[model samples]
Target: MAVAGVLVLARSVRMTTKFTSALDIPVEFVTKNVKLRGKLHHITEKGLEVEHIPISIPLITSIQRKWQSKGLLLVKLAGVEWAPSGMAWLQQELKPKQMIWFQLLGREELALECLVLVNKGRFLSVCLNEEILRQGLGRTVPIKGLPHDSHLHWKLHRRLLRAELKALKKHKGIWQEESYYERLRDRISSNRVVQVNSP
Candidate 1:
């Protein structure tokens, strides 16, 4: 095939990253723009743990600061205060029902409580059960661990770790950003496994 022919035939493919909803928001729309309405439940080293509880004027004032819900999903996404562990500790962190936009979809709504796994300061990987990934996104997959977590999960089998990073970066920037969402978008777009020109 001629070079021009190949160029004309080529199509940019973008791999949409879906969070396995260790909580409830759908992963398909993770990076897409969406809206969410709910009470902010938790913010830990993990991810946002929000509740479907309808907002009330009085309740809003009561839960100004992030508070733990005395329920099964006790801890949502842990905040920098409790867990200033790695790079995520640097995260300004979102507050309950504060209504902040996210790297994922714009949806402020959160599902059940899930652990937000910060991966190599590149991508936000949530540690979810295999079922959520399968059911939420509707697919059969391999290695449920986040890209960065893969190293720990697989015991840092060097070659394997390199392999995962190589593949994961091809998808998007999950960690390490200037904290500017646009730069984050640029890095994810240019450095992803599957690339596409999105609208």
Candidate 2:
């Protein structure tokens, strides 16, 4: 099509469309502009893969510090300070076979960078990554090639930084009063456990 003395390609036209969720909030009226809803199926080196979205979906975002592949995601969610390596815990918390929602922060190659939230009953949703960092389960790191809107992106960056600070202060996640070598050891050890446990 031609408009204002310029020709628009069909490919460009197709890319402009946005996704709206029927399972969650409406498109225009919602505070979060871009959203995706699906089931949590698996995890990748960098993020989570979601299903039932009718498209290729991977949800991940930039962290303040990246996790060195522990091979297994070690989560200490219970009252204790540490927990074993098991996918069952995550699956239970995320609730398998149910539709979950992701608020897209931005886009990266092959997936949408999103805030994965779990619903705490009616109208309340929790960002899993943020909560993880806040509770000292993980750390955050920034990645390159984020969105060009500095204002919006900076806001997200600040939020991640704040979460990291909280983790550091409480010595949560990988920062729990361990030496560098020991932290590395823990990461590797957890992975070994996962490998032995995987069927």
* Highest lDDT scorer: 2
What is the overall TM-score of model 1 with all chains considered together? Answer: 0.22
Please report the candidate that would top TM-score against the real structure. 2
Tell me the spans in candidate 2 whose CA falls farther than 4 Å from its real position: 1-33, 53-92, 143-145, 179-199
- Go through the candidates in order and give the C-alpha RMSD of each one to the true structure: 22.6, 15.9
Give the per-residue lDDT of model 2 (tens digit) for 87-189. 3335456654456666655343344555566789798987665666676655565523345455765676677668767877777656674446678999999
Each prediction's whole-model lDDT (CA): 0.33, 0.49
Cα lDDT tens digits, model 1, 29-122, are 3433232233455555444554333223453435532442332122232111122332242234333354322223122333232223333344
Q: What is the clash count for each candidate, in the order shown? A: 32, 8
